[model samples]
Target: MKPWILGLTGGIGSGKSAVAQHFIDLGVHLVDADHAARWVVEPGKPALSKIVEHFGGELLQADGQLDRTALRKRIFANADDRRWLEALLHPLIGQEIMQYLARAQSPYAILVSPLLIESGQHTMTQRVLVVDAPEQLQIQRTMARDQSSDEQVQAILKAQASREERLRHADDVLLNDRDLAWLQSEVERLHHFYLSLRGGQV
Candidate 1:
């Protein structure tokens, strides 16, 4: 049977990864765009060579790998640079994600992407799940998790689609401002819902 594909998205530090992990624990296959993004740009990959050629070697670490910190700073400092990078990387990431989904073996698969809404890839899925929290909480969590400054976190948030925009597209919303138990219950409920949908019981 073709697996049911769910596009899971959320603002930075809204516990999207934690929620995806819950699905993984429930035996749902997972395809993470961030992981695919990283894989496509690994040292020997074509994407890496293209990035080095376009952005120059300054964006590379001593090991000849992409220096994410340097690249992030450069991209955030200029909209044109950010768009240029996205134009190059987004298609590559999308291709990798599609490949993973094609081979997914579980009853259903979850595609976790921070840019799912903005990139329009959510259209490829049967369900759109959003992990949501207040902007202040999202900012705090992001700063704490990444050890980034408030300004940097805000910049990243500004680059992403707003909470309302994401919620408008959601088929399921998981409020992650509370405790893990609540998150677990939501995940379990959604798992069953997705299974039912896949079984033509929707």
Candidate 2:
């Protein structure tokens, strides 16, 4: 049988990476959709080739790497383009994640995706664990990390599931408004809780 899968998600800059890291440190296997997304789009990959076919070589640098900025701009401006791109990438990412989870050796494995809830990945998991912070905090963190303009940050936020929506769907929630020590404690607490969920023998 497939081991229990914990779906982890949050909005941009909600500290999901930090949360996931703690789970990793505690030995949970991680199947990251973000990594799969990047992998599937690597140069010469079929997904990348298809993306280039639809979006054009303008989205390719001279080195044949994806011009992510140009592609991001296009998808953000056009809803249809965004859907097409999602259709192309999401399945490939999901397939890779499934392969990783199938071999998971931990009490449970984490399926980490920014779009876990929005893209219906939560339904595939046994539990949904959300990392949450205030919307304003998300905006501030994203802007500082990405050097993104306020408008750009807001637009990315708008495209994601609302913070309230993510919380409402969560089987568990980690509030990430505090310091690293606090976050570490929360993850540790949840780590044991999950282990107990596997009958406390891990």
Candidate 3:
């Protein structure tokens, strides 16, 4: 039987990683789409070879690893290129996620993806949990953490689903604009709620 899954998502700098770690602390297995995405495009991976064939060797560094920053710039600058890259990578990432989830020993698993709703990965889960913060807060946090410029952050935000759209699809929302202690408390509450849900349904 398929294991129960909770899809977790948030925009960049929205504290999804912090919330995910709290769930990890409570013993839930996690499948991260970002990790899967990177895995699929690693040095020896078929996806990376295909990418090189399509975009040229300039997309790879001297170490043969993908030049992610270069690729990011290319895709974000062109909608068609972005769509093409997504079409190539999303299926591979989905396959990786499912394989990991199937092996999880935890009672329930969490699938974390920044593009969960946009990429249709939410369909794999029973529920969607969105971590939310104000747009300005997101920008500030991202700039601090990644050393990204204001324009770069703005471009990333433009690529993701709007904050309101994410909230609209959320089965649960973790408002992460406050301090860490409050966030941890909310995670604990949700952990119990999820456990209760499992008992009732399965």
Candidate 4:
């Protein structure tokens, strides 16, 4: 049977990873879109050959791996490039996500993606969970964790869906302005809640 999928998303630095970890601790299966994206473009993948063909082989590293940092800068700076890359990769990533979810042994699976709403991946899920934090907190946390400049973070924020828009689509919201203990407790609470929603469960 197809497992119930809970889509988890949040803005940059909104503690989505931490929340996802808690769910993992409780034994929920998870398929992360970011990982799937990377997988689709790996060295032997057809997607990598197309990228090298279009963007030139200079984007590949010494080990023949795609230089993701260089590719990210190129795409983010140009809308056309961004659209082209997305068009090539989203379907492949979606297929990977579905395959992983189909193999889930848990009561439910989580599809964790930063772009769950923006990329329409939430349509595959039965519920959408949003992890939220104030914009200032998001900026600060991202800067601290990623060592990114304020301007870089701002550009990423601008590219993403607005906070209000994300909340509008949410079936559940986890406000992550609190401490780790509180976040873990909330994850545990939601885990049980999700288990209760299983197809044959009362």
Candidate 5:
């Protein structure tokens, strides 16, 4: 049977990773685009070869691995460079995601992607679940978690779709502003609901 796919997304620092982990603990297969994106461009991957051809040898470390920090600095500084990198990586990431979903053995699979809405990939899911928090909270959380400066956090947030835009696109919205216990309960409820929808008693 084809596994039902749930596209899970949120703004940076919105606790989307926590929500994804909750679903995973409930036995839902997870295909994380961030992980797949990295996998596709590893030293020996075809995606890395394409990237090297386009971006030149300077983007590589002395050991031949992709220099992620260098790429990040370049992409954020130049819109054209960001687009160029995305064009090369996104399709390869999509292919890997599809392959993972095809091999999933669970009742449903969750694709956790920070850029799911922005990239227009939410259309691929059976449902869209958005993990959300207030902008102030998001900024604070990001700063704390990533050890990033306010300016850096703000810039990253600006690069993503606004909170309102993501909420509008959500079939299910998880407000993650409270304590972890509250978030846990919400995830449990959602898990049961998902199972019920799949014709299983939860």
Candidate 6:
């Protein structure tokens, strides 16, 4: 049987990872989209070969792996390239995500993605969970954690779905303006809620 999928998403620095970690600690399987994206482009994968063919072999490192930093610069500058890359990668990533979900033994598994809403991943889930914070806090935290410039972080936020749009799709919401202890407690509430929904004793 397909396990229930609890899709978790948030903007940069909105604490999606922190919330997902709490769920992970409670034994929920984590099928991370970012990890699946990378997996689809591993050295032996067909997706990697297609990327190298289209962008040139220089996109590969001396070790014959993708040079993600270089590719990010190119794609960000050109919309056509971005679309082409997305067309190549998204399907492969989706397959990997489905495979992980199939093997998960938890009452449910969480598919954690920054682009869950924008990439249409929420359609595959039983519930959409948004980890949200104010836009300013998102900017501040992303700048600190990623060592990114304000301009860079702001650009990323611009490309993502607006905060309102994310909230509009949420079946559950985690407001992450407080400390870690508070976040953990809220996660506990949601954890039990999920268990209850699945008809399991918690």
Return the top candidate by TM-score. Answer: 6
Model 4's C-alpha root-mean-square deviation from the true structure amounts to: 2.0
Candidate 6 per-residue lDDT over residues 1-202, each given as its tens digit: 4568899999999998889889989999989999999999899999999999899998999999899999999998999999999998988889999998889898888899999999998877888889999889999999999999999999999989999999999988899999999999999999888877762212
For residues 100-129, write the lDDT of model 5, one tens digit per residue: 888878877888999898887776788888
The residue pairs in collision within model 5 are none
Candidate 4 wrongly placed segments (more than 4 Å):
199-202
lDDT for 170 in candidate 4 is: 92
Q: Which one wins by TM-score: 2 or 5? A: 5
Model 5: what TM-score?
0.91
Worst 10 residues of 6 by lDDT: 193-202
C-alpha lDDT of candidate 4 relative to the true structure: 0.93
Q: Which RMSD does model 1 reach against the true structure?
A: 2.3
Candidate 1 residue lDDT tens string, 111-168: 9999999988887788888999988999999988999999999999998998889999
lDDT of 6 at 97: 95
Error of 1 at 28 (Å): 0.9
Across 18-92, the per-residue lDDT of candidate 2 in tens digits comes to 999989999899988878878888898998899989988899999988988999999989999999999988788
- Give residue 6's lDDT in candidate 1 (0 to 100): 90
lDDT of the candidates, in the order given: 0.89, 0.88, 0.91, 0.93, 0.87, 0.90
Clashes of 6: 0
Runs in model 6 deviating more than 4 A are: 199-202
* Per-residue lDDT over 54-171 for candidate 3, one digit per residue giving the tens place of the 0 to 100 score: 8899999999999999999999899998888989998999999999999978767899999998899988888899999988999999999999999999999998998888898898
Which is the better candidate, 5 or 6, if ranked by lDDT? 6
Alpha-carbon lDDT of model 6: 0.90
- Cα deviation at 202, candidate 3, in Å, is 10
Tens digit of lDDT per residue, candidate 4, span 142-198? 999999999999999998999999999998999999899999999999888888886
What is the lDDT for 16 in model 6? Answer: 89
